[model samples]
Target: MRAVRSIKGRLGTAAALAVPLAAFATEASAHVKWFCAYDVAGQPRGLAEVLCADFEWLTGLALACLMLGCLAEGTPLGIALLNALDRVTTRIRTDTHLLVRVTLGFFFVSLWSLGGIILTPELTTDAAWIPWLQLGLAGLLISPRTTPLVGFGIVFLFAYATAQYGAFHLADYPVFLGVAAYLILTGLGISVLGLRPIDVVRWTAAITLMWASVEKWAYPHWTDPLIAAKPAMTMGASPELFMKAAGVIEFTLAFALIWTPLVRRTSAIILAGIFVSAVFEFGKVDAIGHSGIIVVLLAIAADDVRAAASRRQVVLAPAYYGAALAGFLALYYVGHALLFGGPAELTGMPVI
Candidate 1:
């Protein structure tokens, strides 16, 4: 009886650990391929179709849940969690050295050269000058004095690449580009408009995740092919259900970033782990695509923004922020559905 009880306890502990391990492992894994439509041959079929009718009701229910969760934030448990989070954030270290910046620059340049990082990697026009341009930018980023120029150049290149690919088709990756640009800008400079660059990187990174999360909710079917290919992603749950849960997890983490510095760092760490895991599945493109986000997460981890003891300012109260986020998501998803028919209608159809 004693041996049996010990075995049972061991099993229970394994089960508990497995749940979070699975969740973290799957974070952001079903990306790139999902946001846009694709054929069975793995060919791009253009923008993903948004099935409004299928998910509209679900979205509403999720919003209601969010509202309830937000209300709960005012309770003692929430306050305690927030206070604990503040303590963690206050202890983070934000000071970065020149070597880190130079290393990051070298890494990005190498990725660009390898054709890992770019908008619509498979679809870009074959141009000889692009590599040279990337190398030039990388060189510029090595110096503190030239970092801002390289930053602006990167912003332009990313924008140009997106425009070349047709902006509407690529969808949310541009948000990642914006984060990269900001990181470059701030890493080279002390501050932007009196705000620490790391702070801006934290906020922007959070926003990028939040924005990408909506696509999962709005177009779950976009990920159907991926789920079909990798059944393990479902982890025994229905594909639809898993997609919805994934979106909620991503959005909740992103929302947590705004709540406290501790939460921000925690979210960044989790997100970085997810991105790292994705590289194993998606290869070089995943690494290239997520490099900027990973860098931002690292910066957030290094940031040491402490809360003022005298006056703690809540940037946006949880309740109001949650409500506003819900409203914005509804508008964006519904509007997208109206403009472009849902996945069922657009499957195999080219956006252009």
Candidate 2:
């Protein structure tokens, strides 16, 4: 009996650490409630499985492909970016700002070409709209010389198109509207704030970071397995509802950071720390394939932080696959599944 008690104690201790780690990994907003299908191992109310991808899913794919290509051409892009940074860092080394702008223009043309090829019709039912909308966002993010009117026209045109098509769905409405509103409001906010061009770009990136962080916070249950009865893992499990609580913390921090300029950099760093720790603790062996963008975004956030501090801004570049977004995101979700098992099982819901 004494031996049995000792073994039980050790088992309990290990499980405790495992649960929270698992919960947080899959807890990110971008991945949350994304593609949960009826095939989901128990009978948790899975989303209706559609035959083809929706606009959002297609947009995500385009964003992914765009990022992948950018990473592939990392050397030139990085050099051009570095030169742009040099221009920003000081007044006069050489009058090569126009060259950097020209380099970015070429990148944009290449982006359009890539979007044409990679955003294939097979992936999305709403194929007509997806590339166009994503391409618009890409434009705003890339050009260091973009004006608010140019951005406004691009975003508004897409918004008008979506409205014309009446393609909005209940599940996607909030996020779509929210992101749209963010772009418009921020445009106005930048005008009011008298923000520089680079500042607008950085703020756009920062807001996205903040929103992504807030997403997980809003749906903490997606990650928490201890919100399970069997409690497969410890870190993702909750002895005292820690996952839910942490959700509150992350959500609050993300929101606070988005609205407050001074806190934005700090918020980006905090969010990055949270994501990196979550990845290390709970990400699975195959995480690299899926969650790569999130990781790269964090690294990009680091650049934003430094830029904000040094130059009071960051010149936004077009979206690119970045170093390892898929890998990182993939690891995170895999960890969530490995650690948590299934939502219905955790919650004691009868399996379908």
Candidate 3:
């Protein structure tokens, strides 16, 4: 009775602690979600180059193609494509997972639509679900199986369309092959690696940190625009340090999540904040803001994203991964010293 009572009290205490933290995470993750669209020129892209670079434009072009396909294919063809997609997705038989995924994707897109129109500077008032309604129209083409092909075909067409753009470089055609290659590899990686939630959290955190770190490291001026754009960034005590420290913190936390269980719990809590910031920071722009919303939706569904492990696993895994992390960092320290001159995990080990 004493031990049981002790356990209950501890549980109650832990729950109490978690409440404020959870609220902080949610509020931090929350962006000024727009409920309508604006017609402002040049306001489409955010301050981040990721919001303006190939990734952003390509996504926009792809979505535009999805729009075109819906227009070209019409309602019947869309339904037929969906039915065909259902058949294809069933082959792998991850329908339950895929259903959850697509629904989240839909929900996030809708949220983005709401945010896009509400925050945008140009559109009158009716464009609330603009991109999302387009997404909905295209959603008809979104059967698990067919959605892949549809998404692929649309992206491909966009790339092809863009070959005629920008200096009219006939040479640019080969460049697209690399992009195509990346998409193929990405699709495969997601299916193969994302089978486990632990893998998802670890890799996503690592990737996010790496990407964030590289932008600042490569260009000293990189964060100036970011700080300028996010009013909240200014509020952070030492925004510059906050930016740099956030990168290192994420990198370390990602390592902890993968290798240390106790740290995983702590790191997961922090990462929840990191991801929300990433989403809000990204989502404020034209293209990626919506993408951020989509990712957030995915995060919500993948219960194991920051999920708790079994008690037994928790007891054993943290120490194992922690020890592993020490060795890995040591190895990194040496390799960086010998070859790269010094450890740039802080600034030099740039994002791939």
Once model 3 is optimally superposed onto the true structure by TM-score, how far is the C-alpha of residue 61 displaced, in angstroms?
A: 43
Whole-model alpha-carbon lDDT for candidate 2: 0.36
Instruction: Compose the digit string of candidate 3's lDDT tens values, residues 212-317.
Output: 3323322323345444565464354454444333333333444544432233333454555445555544554433333422332233223222233234543454
Question: Could you give me the TM-score of model 3 versus the true structure?
Answer: 0.39
User: How would the candidate models be sorted by lDDT, starting from the highest?
Assistant: 1, 3, 2
C-alpha-based local distance difference test score of model 3: 0.37
Q: lDDT values of the candidates?
A: 0.57, 0.36, 0.37
Candidate 1, run of 10 with poorest lDDT: 40-49
> Largest lDDT belongs to which candidate?
1
Better of 1 and 3 by lDDT: 1
| Per-model TM against the reference | 0.68, 0.36, 0.39
> Which residue segments of model 3 deviate by more than 4 Å?
1-104, 107-142, 145-147, 150-205, 225-236, 260-269, 277-352
Per-residue lDDT of model 2, residues 1-352, tens digit only: 6654654574466347444533543344323333221122232222222112342343344344333323422244333434443334343224222332333234334435445321111112334554455456456645444424434544554455445433321212222233333344444554435554334444444444433433333344555442354353335544234433343344334343333232333344445455555455434321321232233223223333222221212212121122123332333333333444544434354545
